[model samples]
Target: MSLQGNLTQQVEAYHNWKKELIRQIGRYRLWLQDNNLFSDDISARIRHGLELLVEDELTIAFVGEYSRGKTELINALFFSEFGQRMLPSQAGRTTMCPTELFFDRNANENYLLLLPIETRIGDLSLQQLRKQPERWVKHDLDERDPEIMREVLGEVARVKAVSTAEARALGFDEGMLEHDRNNPGKVLVPAWRNAQISIRHPLFERGLRILDTPG
Candidate 1:
């Protein structure tokens, strides 16, 4: 089957599974409510426990240095059905920045959201970046062509030049500054801090968010 068709089947399976889970959780909630009539102390503990199961999105984060087979590990664990590497894995300096993959059930299409490195120099904090969608570059997903998928996802390797002074202000120390000295006045850095890709993978549809951080 094609990638999309495979993803759709996976997602459908996940949806059916989630429906059963929700039903069970709902029944548990009603049971708890009924038990609350028996005791005040027990009710507080049950309420606290229930709060943790509040149907929130679960995030799975990966952390490590460049290479070390981080992406390769993810590909093997979750994307093995591809029978190929789902992510671009290089031996060194691969996955230059963080990349997040998640499913947006409401999203009409798949795309990658890139926040420019320039955003770091501005007054906007990471939280504000989400609010300013205009500052991001969105690349539509093209799974039909392997080369296109490679090109779009490869944006994580994008780089830009920053002045020495500005780079230091962003927490770069002297050692890093000296190593990246380019023309005595600037330094080259990854063009983006993180990349968010929306795809139709089954894990994503089940609130499975994968964070491929600089590893």
Candidate 2:
């Protein structure tokens, strides 16, 4: 079996185990209720615990400086089935912003949501912005074509030249940007503040979320 197949099998097995465990817990709770062995507070606590278990997600994060192979490792480990690099991995800083990969069960569709760097000027935090769908630029994904997917995914690494004042206004440190002779008085910075990629991969569908920190 391919790596993707193996991972899918392992995730499915774990999912089944969780379902069986939840069923066993439910039965125990019922027994407790019938025997009058648990108080109202105990029952509530048990219910809360079960809710946590059901809602739990597995998050794996990769953190390092530029050109550290974080993105490359991610492609090799989870996305090799694409027969090419799924995420943009190159010789230099490719991931311009913190990128999240997961499957949104609620949406039930594959798409890429990009938060513009201009949004950084707002008072809202990243977490708050996520709730405001209108604030993001949505790109519907076509997984059937790997070339199309690659083209869309490459947007995460896109950068644009901006004036120093503009970069500062976007919450970027002017000192971090180097002076370029090719583009004097212009600072290059990431076009997007963050990227949220939703796909229908097996591991992701099983509640796995991968965080690729900025490179």
Candidate 3:
């Protein structure tokens, strides 16, 4: 057989295997749901993992220095189909906090959840925030309206005033503080610690997730 023929066969076999794995994951999810396989909390987690697998979730994480173009990479790679910047990818330091992009078919409407940076004062970790959705300030996303979408997406850049001591407790050091951003009684900081954006996109519909973080 020709070399090209052999390579094609290998590629086809890999895809076939992947499809079978996804199907099995789906079956497992159904089995868990139908049988009440575990406690409510445990089951929820197990089911969530299963669903992502069954849906063939592909998560890409971009992490680098402040001006490293991580957002642009995400836009060009996945959101370019929209022919416009969906996220705040621009020339300057755009992404002030970590952001996650994904789609949930179970979600009835588009939304963005901003978990406050102040929560760190309560010693609540990211895992704790997952269980405490009430702690996140939720925003409705309107993709159909470009103006609204722009306003909504701009929330990532929201800033708040915090005392230097409070900022230090959040792990910011003197060297990290921007002199020009300081106010008389407080230092400016990103209003949010993290963001979860749920929107309907073809790539996300196919179970793709993008994790963009500051490096």
Best by lDDT: 2
lDDT of 2 by residue, 1-215 (tens): 87666766777887898899899999999899899898989888998989988998878799988899999988897777789998899997789989999999998999999999999888999999999999999998888998999899999998888999999898889898755467899988899999999999878988989999875
lDDT of the structure predicted as candidate 2: 0.89
Candidate 3 lDDT tens digits, 1-215: 85434634554565577688768876876787688784678767776875665566566689888878888877666555557777787765678789999887787567999998878778777988888889999989887775677678888867777788888888777567554344686777778899999888765665667899865
lDDT of 2 at 152: 94
Worst 10 residues of 1 by lDDT: 173-182
Model 2 alpha-carbon drift over 4 Å, by segment: 1-17
For lDDT, candidate 1 versus 2, the one ahead is 2
Greater TM-score among 1 and 2 belongs to 2
Q: Local distance difference test, per candidate?
A: 0.72, 0.89, 0.76
Task: Give stretches of model 3 more than 4 Å off.
Answer: 1-17, 22-56, 81-83, 181-185
Q: Candidate 3 has which clashing residue pairs, if any? A: none
Quote each prediction's TM-score. 0.71, 0.88, 0.73
The order of the candidates by lDDT, greatest first, is 2, 3, 1
C-alpha-based local distance difference test score of model 1:
0.72
- Arrange candidates by TM-score, highest first: which order? 2, 3, 1
Tell me the tens digit of each residue's lDDT in model 1 across 4-35.
46655665665576667767766776787787
- Backbone clash count, each prediction separately: 0, 0, 0
Give each prediction's root-mean-square deviation over alpha carbons.
5.5, 2.3, 7.8
